[model samples]
Target: MKKENLPPFKITNEILTLIYEIGELIGKISVTQEFEKNLILRRENRIKTIYSSLAIEQNTLTLEQVTDVINGKRVLAPLKDIKEVQNAYEIYERLDELNDNSVKDLLLAHKIMTSELIKENGKFRSKNAGVYQGEKLIHMGSMPAHIPELINNLFLWLKNSKEHPLIKAAVFHYEFEFIHPFQDGNGRIGRLWHTLILSKWKDFFGWLPIESLVQKYQKEYYTAINNSNRDGESTEFILFMLKIINETLIELIENQKMTDKMTDKMTDKNKKRIEVILKYLSQKNYIDNKEAQNLLDVSEATAKRFLNKLVKENILEAVGEYKARKYIKK
Candidate 1:
């Protein structure tokens, strides 16, 4: 393939517009320090991504089981399925270290993502391959002899293409699925790499769990792929993916707004009391409920509620237990 050769896709009006909307939603989020600091939310999103991606490939683990496995608890699912979840987590947690443009890193990712589960882990298939849904094949890959050059050409174009990352990511996803480059784990890896490509454009895509939405629209996801295959271009898939990304961004932004409204939902008096507590904490080490009652000139119960509200909003953290608890800067 020549450097000027681009992939089989078109830049339709809808793809461009969704890209713009996704960018707008992205700009609206500072989210909060909590989104970054809240390890629980991060873990949940990671688990959601792993569960949904594997579920698309017919992995037998439930969401609860995936969570348990990631949390280092024993789950009764098939050992192979459990290993797939583990492998996915391993790869996602190490996202900062992988290069989106390198075929070498792609293979390394495949290796880690399929280790102990597939006989051809880390290597491209030595025979022709196709994507399957249940017992039916939906798409066939290039012949075994063509796999290496096709992948190399794809990557070379990926590095050189001037297309938007959203478009590029979708095209790579469509092409990777079209290539079915590996003997197994193509769907999961294709989705993972699409996210890696976008995460390169925006860091938070790594944790955004677009897979959950894809899982919600699983039938449409495959239909989009099948449509692109039938049409001989990836325009259908690109439109489908850009919409998913836009929807995820809208969801994130709305959730962030709701979290912000926790403060908005406060009564005027409660809001003033919160302001007082914040001011006090700027100079003091911590604020106990007794101190809160005295400073805010309120009853013990009201003062305690205010302090707890601050804690829940992530503006302050509660330390100690029961009557001994104190509120400190988070």
Candidate 2:
């Protein structure tokens, strides 16, 4: 479908304004700080978790199965469907190599990540398929003969669009999902490739896990896409994606501010206390009063009270019974 002839899709000024603001804030985030390293690790972990969860929800695997793959307890195998969780990891690991503007590199990344699913895993499908809505399918099938040309044209638009890179990436994501080009793994590929495209425009996006935000609203994500397919317009999906991006940015900024405030006020005593907690958490996500007391050189009641206070303030999460309780950073 031609860009102008496709639909009346357009972004609202309100969302455009928010995107610019977020772009500015993200540009200002310092990448050299120790805290930034922690943030990047946390973001990467969340991204993996989100991709894994989505794959599971799509019935490609169970939650336990995806976790096993992520933890390296299982090797990838060609199975019932594409292992999207594995594909997500492959993309993230090789992002540095594909950071340049070469279309060939991007296509190669897609092929490498998806080759197990179909003969054309990383490439567009040569056969036609209909876009679906409920039990109904719309747009009918593209002429089998025209499938190759249609996909090539779509990719050409993706490469040439003059839209804001972020907006273009979002549009391409929706279009790819609507086209359902591959025999399988279309949703996962579309989302991952969109992240790849956006990361090329802004290095910070290489670390931002927008999938986590989308996972939180999966119903909306699917509905927005289906609605746009029915209407032949992607404006709703673009607006929805922009909102997700904005909310994710706000959450990250708020968390960073809180961490900064906590760090700034750290005395030698509290710094030592936090160091003890971090060491314990690095091994496992939780610690009990006994462990805290032993690590922090504090009385049992003092340890309990301090840990409980952190939980109450939303800075930590508590689990298990009173004496058996453990704390985790929120």
Candidate 3:
């Protein structure tokens, strides 16, 4: 396909300005070392991502509940909602394994995300599905008969387009939602894939928690989509997302600075990430990497890092080794 086959979007001046601002912020954020290799930050970001994405869909599970559910703890929430957090955690954890341009992978992700929740899991709708408000239909998805080719063409345009990844990712997000490929879970999966596209372009985005901001301004998010829908172009949605990306980067920078201010030393900084875990450890007989990982919704490596750091700080003692390794409060 040629450039002419690209989705209908204009590269307006506002879009270009946001792109520049985002670039500058990305540079600053990258150098600030907020998320360079910090498992704690990434873990927090992933939690925010899951919570916000689900929250936008009216999941009603609080952020704390989402974090708890991800760590394998029981949460007093609806079963379907709890399953959503579990499924999202599993999908995001495997971000490294997904190819953003692969339509097959998209279906697989939907399967993982919506299994046991929707009968249309892992497949496009064969019947017309539309966004609803109360009993009133607000927005109708594409005709079910055309979904297969629409998604393929959309992916092709995304993969081959000359636009910046930031713009392409945002445009892809709006276009994906417009197509509304799945009968359910379209909102969550669209946001996940948006993050996926950016993370592929810049690994830092794998845990940026843009959805937290999306959920914050969810009305604007939907408004942008509706505006794009009305105009028959994605420029409005593109502008909206670029602004969100810029703002997210700004928050990351500001947050790192605040984290710095909250600490007088590196150890103090480390301590802040696990105040709860340490308190929880004080009452427990033992805590292992799996338990800590669940407690923090962090990776195994991240959990080990925290535990080893604590041991060195004389706050916890390491016992056993390998799979038998555990930590006890000193």
Q: Evaluate all candidate structures by whole-model CA lDDT and list the values in order.
A: 0.85, 0.67, 0.85
Q: Write the residue-wise lDDT of candidate 3 on 1-330 in tens digits.
A: 113556888998988898998888887775436566666667878988999999999998987788789778888989999999999999999998999999999999999999899998999999998987789877899899889988999999888888899988988898889888898999999999999999998888998999999999999999999888888889899999988888999988886775555344556546555666754553356899899988877899998998897777666789997999988877
What's the lDDT for candidate 1?
0.85
**Candidate 2 or 1, higher TM-score:** 1
Where does model 3 exceed 4 Å of error? 1-5, 265-330
Worst 10 residues of 2 by lDDT: 40-49
Kindly list the per-residue Cα lDDT of model 1 for residues 100-185, writing each as its tens digit: 99999999999999999989999999987777778998777878888889899899889998999999999999988888889898
Lowest lDDT block of 10, candidate 3: 260-269
Error of 2 at 72 (Å): 2.1
Per-candidate clashes, comma-separated: 0, 0, 0
TM agreement with the true structure for every prediction: 0.79, 0.75, 0.80
Q: lDDT tens string, model 2, 6-40?
A: 42477789768967987887765665553345653
Please identify model 1 stretches exceeding 4 Å from their true place. Answer: 1-5, 31-35, 263-330
